[model samples]
Target: MVRLGNLVNAEGRAARAAIVDYGYRTGLLSGLAPEPRERQGAWLTPRRLAILKLIAQGQPDRKIATAVGCAPKAVTTAVHHILRNLRAEDRAHAVALDHQQGLLTQPLVPLPEHRPRRVFSALEAQLVEALAAGQTKLQIRTSQGLSAKTVSRLLTGAAAAAGVRPRRGYAALVDSAYRGRLLTARAVDRASAPCLPERQHQVLIGIAHGWSDEQIAHRLGLSTATVKTAARLLYGTLDVATRAQAVARGWDLRLLGAPRPATRATARPGAPSRAAA
Candidate 1:
C-alpha cells in the first residue's frame, strides 16, 4: 500500500526535527511541552550560537562539533548550558523557541508554504473573552457553578476549537484569540477609575463588605425599597450580572481598593446588627 510504503520510508527523528524547526515558523505546530519560562538571563557565546544553529539543523553531536570546530564532548556540554540558559527542554525545543523568539532568523530547513489556521467556535470565543477578562479556570468554575470535570472539558473543548492542545496551549489559545479578533487591544489597556453615583457607591461598598440588602438599607438610612433600587442601578452601572461579579469588576476597575472601615461609632436608627450576606 502507498500508506505502508510512506510509513516505512518515514525519516523518523529527522522528520520530527524538521517539524519543530519550521512548524512554528509556518504557524502550524507549537510543541505541546513549551519551552520553560525561566528568564533567559545568561549570555550566549558565538561558539554556543554556532552549536545551536547546527543543532537546529538536526545535526548529531559529532556533526555539531565538527561544524563549530569543537570536540563532541564540548558540544554536549554546551548543549547543557543552552538548555539551562534558554530554559529549553531539548535541542529541537531550543530550535522552535529560537525561531519563535527570533534568536535564529533563517531556519536551515525550508519553511512550510502554508500553515493550518486556528479557528474557534462561538462558545470558545466567549470563553476567550472571559479569560481575557482575568477569570481563571477555577474562578470560572465557581462563578459559572460548573463541575470540575465540566470545566476541564469546556476549557479543553475551547482549546480544540482554537486548534490548540488543551491546557498546554494556553499561550497559543490566547494568541489565536487575539489574531481572530475575539479579544480586543483596547481591553488590554488599563481601565480608568469607575465613577458611580452617591447612592450606588454606598450600596456597592455595603455589598463589598458582605452586607445583605437589608443591612445596606439600614446602614445607609434608606428604605429597603430604595436600597434595592440603588443595588439594581449599581449593577447596571458596573454592567455585571451578579453581586459577586460586581465585586470582582469593582476591584478590576479600581473602584474598590481597600475597604474603608465603618467610621461611625453611632449606629443610625433602624440599623441592624452586622451579619454576612
Candidate 2:
C-alpha cells in the first residue's frame, strides 16, 4: 500500500521516482552509465530531469515549445538530446529513471531562457482543473463528451508530470496495479512471489461482500486475473480451495475483517472459477 508519506516525504518521493526510472532503464543503459572522473560520454543532467518533469506533467511538444519559446520540433529535439545523455530509450523511460533517482523531489529550479518550459493543451489543461476540483472521470467524460479512455489518457498525461505512466485502459491499469502489488510483495520476500498477508485478507473480505472483479481490480489497480491468482495463492498459503474456505480460514487466522457468517453468498452461476483459465 502506498501510504501518504510515500508521496509526502521528499526523500521517499525522490527514491520512488528513481526506482521507476531505473526500472524503465533496465536493459537500456549501456553508454549512459556513470563515467569515471576521467571517462566521459554523457550523464544524467538537470536539463534531462527538467524534460522528464515536463513529460510527466503531460505537456505536448507544442506547448513545451511555447512555454520555452522554441520551435515545436525543439521539444522533440531536446528530448532526444536528453535521452542520449541518459542512455534511455524514450521520454517515458527517461522520466521513469528520473523518478527512481529522486531527481524530481527537489524544488523546480527554473532554467535560463535557453532552457525549455512545458506547455499543456486547453483540453488537457481543463482535465487537470477538473481533477483538482475533485471531479470524477465519469463526470468529466459526460460533460465533455470524451470517452472514459480519453479521460484516463488525459489524466495519465497530466499526472506524468512526475513521470509515472498514466495507466492506459481501465482493464490494463487494473492488471498492472494488481501485478505491481504482487511484484512489490514478492520484492519484499525475494525468494518467492507472495501477496502481502494483510492484502490477501482484505481481498477475501471484499470478495465475500460480493464485490465484482472489475471493482476490486479498479480499486487495487490490478487485473481480474491477478486478483484471482492472488486469491488462489492466498488459498494455497492458507490450505484452502474455495472462496468460502479461504474466507473462513482467513477470518479464523484474523487475516480478514471479522467474518460474517450470514453473508454466505456463492459465486455467481456460470462464472468461471479461474480468470483466463
Candidate 3:
C-alpha cells in the first residue's frame, strides 16, 4: 500500500525469489534454470564450497578470513570467484546454484518469530536502512562512511542479537532482523528535507522513483500542476535544477536508496567482472 509513486517493488522481487527458492527446495526448478556448464565440476573445488557454506552461515569476510586463515580481502575475492564459477548473480543466487548442483545439501532454515525493534547507532542505522533499500555495498561505503568490513561487523552484531546462526545463514540473518525489527526500510519519503512540506517530500520520493509528474499527481491525489510546483520546490531545496540532478543529490545525501541494476536476459559473453556486492 505504501507506494511512493511505485518505488521499485524490491519486496516483490524478494517474494518471487522466495517462490523460486521453494521450487528448488522441492526439486522442481532445476529444469527451468540454465543447465550447468561442463567446467563447473572442475571449478568448484573443496575450498570454494567450504567458503560458500560460511557465506550461507552468515559469516562476514573478516570472520570468514579468520576461520579460513586468509585475509578479509581474500575472502571477498574468493567469494567473487565462487559466484563466477556458479554463474550466480548474488550471494543468495549462489546459494540456490549450489543447492541445484548438489553441493549444498542442507535446506534453508525457517525464520523464528518477530523480535522487538532494536535501537542502532547512527552508522548502523544508515547502513541497515541503505541495505534494506537495496543499496549496493559501494553506494553505502561512498555515501554513508562505511567500509565493507565495517558493514560485515554490523551484520554479525545484528545477527547475534536476532539469534541467527549458521543454519539460517547470512540472508537468513537479514530476514530475521527484518522480522525482529532490528532493521527498518525507509519509505522513499523518509528521505524528506527539513524545509520541504510533507507533500513535497512525497513528490521528491516519487521523482526518485522515476515517476512521471502525471504519475506522481495521480498517486498523490493532486493535479499535475501541483505536482510540478512541488517538484520545483524540491529542486530549490536540493539546490538542483533538473530531475536527474535532484535524484543524484538525493543519493549523495543518503536521502534515496540505491539505483536498480539493469536487467538482462543472459550474462554477457565474458568473464564475470569484480563487483562491490
The lDDT leader among the candidates is 1
Instruction: Flag the better candidate by TM-score, 2 or 3.
Output: 3
Model 3, TM vs. native: 0.28
What residue pairs clash in candidate 3, if any at all?
56-169
- Tens-place lDDT digits, model 2, residues 1-277: 1542243232332344344444444544434554222211333343344446656555566655544334667568777777676666665565655554545564323211110012233455465444423355777798899987888776664333212234322212211212222101111233443333433544554554335556666555457886776676666776654443443343334333221222122222433211110
Stretches of model 1 off by over 4 angstroms after superposition: 1-15, 30-39, 106-277
- Scored by lDDT, model 2 comes in at 0.44
Q: Encode model 1's per-residue lDDT on 1-277: one tens digit a residue.
A: 3342243332444334444665665666655555445454435654566566666666677766655444789889988899778877766677777776666763222111111133344445555556656567677778778787887776676555444555331434543333333333332125554456545655665665546788767765557887888788777877876664555565455444432222222222342322111
**Among all candidates shown, the one with the greatest TM-score:** 1
Ranking by TM-score: 1, 3, 2
- Cα lDDT for residue 201, candidate 1: 58
Q: Compared with the true structure, what per-residue lDDT tens digits does model 3 show for residues 1-277?
A: 2241133232332333334445566677667665564356555543455567666554556765655444678778888899777777887677676666666663222113323233344455455455545455577678867677887776555445435441211333344334444443334454354444345556656654446788777766568997787788777877775554454445545444332232121222332321112
What Cα-based lDDT does every candidate model obtain?
0.55, 0.44, 0.53
Higher-TM-score candidate of 1 and 2: 1
